[model samples]
Target chain A: MAVYHPDGPLILRLRAGDVDALGELYKRYKTSIYRTALAITRDQGAAEDILQESFLRLFTHAHRIRPDVPLHPWLYRVAVNLSYKWLRKQQKQQKATSDGVLEGLAASFHFLPEQWIERREAQEAIREAITQLPLGHRVVVVLFYLEELSLKEIAEILRIPEGTVKSRLHYARRFLRDTLEGRVPVGEIVYEFT
Target chain B: MSSRDLSSFDPLDRMVKEALQARFAGAEPSPRVWRRIRREAVRQGGRHRSRGIGDWAWFLLMARPTAPLVGRDEFPLGRFGLGMFLFPDAATLMTLRFGW
Candidate 1:
């Protein structure tokens, strides 16, 4: 039974006992998946764990599932669960860093003091608005804008109806627009992917 | 602006997308991912079962055996000890005197 991989042709090789296919899948989605994980976890280490665990699951199941089917949603499902587990584990392991202990003292330090006032203010304003969104709305926004999943696919990934995804997006857009008006600098909004 | 107004372009949408793209650029895989995943995969135990109904990893890893076999080396001849795993010497092969 030959099953072609969903996103890239490399996955097919994985089923044929080829390790190179696994490496290709890793490099292709690592950036976007890591970004999505980072957005949810808000910590680089936690996000890295999510990214790695998701791919590991992919490797383990490389021969079982239909390779032609999209793998990102399955990857997303694994990442989301792992992230929640990590968060729960954090509750049991509590040892605040020195940065947390002397945060008040460190607050007075002028780190990166040379940023243009308007540019820095605009960035802060955008971040504050995103942080203010309801968790569900924020996630939908991240999936749509960052991971670039379609609304239909987002609903499938979140296990909700498409209408609900659309509604949340509508509400999120309005909130962000109101919060960020007159703040974002005027020009083309460009993204230089690293 | 309505969806109609958004037909041409939308700054809010653009800004939101740009903001997310900028943040996503810094993501990467964790070092401890493999150990955790392999543990979970073993626990799952869903796929595989071809060679001998149980873990056939050794068989899969083993080299393929050459074909054709029929000799006094081994066979089910009436009971146990039909033939021992003994290599024939140069004189034994030239004369079949032991079989009778």
Candidate 2:
């Protein structure tokens, strides 16, 4: 009897130039990948672009990928790297924009609501808090809570030490807690998606 | 608050998880993304074929022969009883004869 290996058949078919296998892999992981990109970049268009680029990289580099390993972390690594690249580009462009200057000034001020309200409102508040995190912390939080990847997996994806991942997670959680408890008021959360 | 203070609030983790779930619960990539993926796959397939050995083989087969090795005055010996003719090279003639 042939033993079953998860992701093995799809990867094998992908290596053999089967487009259907690529589509299957995409269908399985696109949501997670898209969410990760969306969480990190906070831009729908950028997330979509990262989603496509990640899979295209997989298609082009399928031969080089080890069939013995799970493909998820590798895909995450590609998405994260692309997200960082996009962030860096935005940072550079923001330096030249007057609106970016005004946004920077607004970020320095803390704006807080008088009292917390409904569950839906609280959820939106938490989402805003996440978006307020710096890119490094935001990514770790997204990977940990949103994607539910282990510290080791996230470390491998980010090419960081496990200890570093732990530290980043700790910092991210603290930042979110502060925001949630009204100790910190991060102004005007930008909702990229309607 | 410090990291330890945050760690003590375990419920925050649950809250964050719930918020993330709620925020992206119904999120789906646009159909255009799949269309783009299919298009890119087709383009990559074309690139793979162009870089393949078969493409090189086809190119070599269709290549116009350099100035014929046999000139008007030269009667090259035909080993297989085939009539002497303007042949490019032994390899080309052999390839044609044996369908190599």
Candidate 3:
């Protein structure tokens, strides 16, 4: 409602005081943020939580927002960090379950659901192959392929080097190919589970 | 055949791309993220202003048009954004690279 350049400048001006801009921005990206969060965290509830927390962090750090600089990457970085924490927590919980218990628990969590049959088995196999990747590779693959973040953006989101992301993606691809083609056993894949 | 070309032509690489594309065959843009972000943006303003006068900077950032917009748009902006953020001009890197 305030008078200023109707282009991007006005958006920035309103952002200085107006709450409408916040609503407008949310209207734009809620799905990608939550979907990306869900793809990594693998929990719908956690994904929604991360979506809220990540945006909340963005609001808290708003002064750090550069009028001309990008926003999604920063928010992504926050969301990815939060998801990584959840992943780490899951790993710790799994580790605390003793040795063979993890495999059993994983079987329960990762196996075919009630509705799944032979056809679904094949689909599950594909996803399982992906889930079987080393944490690094899994993150890269999911973020790039499932969430559709580009290599460079993935780098920003993950706070890693472009070369590192590319290499991880490279290895993730080779590993997934082997897994899906049944050339490698799911348990044999060396995952950077940390 | 040259090694670079051979590596580039790797079936594994091709398969990965194929698999990913196949998985997300009907990938949609992230318009939904914008809606959620707007809600947090205002909630953020309230918290930041309540922090203290010294926290005015934090308040302004929540108010920035570019912040959440950046979050929703960054990945969607494609390879061009990738180059800018990941492989910025050396000068750009030099300036922003103090510490996280």
- Highest lDDT model number: 2
Q: List runs of model 1 lying over 4 Å from the truth.
A: A6-21, A84-117, A181-194, B1-8, B30-100
Runs of candidate 3 with Cα error greater than 4 angstroms are A1-17, A105-119, A183-194, B1-100
Query: Which DockQ value does candidate 2 get?
Result: 0.15
Q: Model 1, range A35-76, lDDT digits (tens) per residue?
A: 787876678888877787787667767766566687778777
lDDT of 2 by residue, B1-100 (tens): 2122234235677677778877775577897987798689878881222222332554544444445854444433332223212233545657789884
TM-score of chain B of each: 0.33, 0.35, 0.31
lDDT of 2: 0.72
Question: Each prediction's TM-score against the native?
Answer: 0.57, 0.69, 0.57
Tens digit of lDDT per residue, candidate 3, span A45-140? Answer: 677778877766655555556656556777677877788888888888877876565466447544445454344454545555666677777777
Interface RMSD of each: 6.7, 7.6, 8.2
For A1-194, candidate 2 gives per-residue lDDT tens digits of: 24155777777767777677788889998999998998788799999999999998888888887777788999999999999999889878977765464355335424545454467767777777777677888888888877777777888999998888888876776677675765323333222111
Off by over 4 Å in 2: A1-4, A99-109, A183-194, B1-9, B46-100
Better of 2 and 3 by TM-score: 2
User: In candidate 1, how many Å is residue A118 off?
Assistant: 2.6
Which candidate tops DockQ? 1
lDDT of each: 0.59, 0.72, 0.57
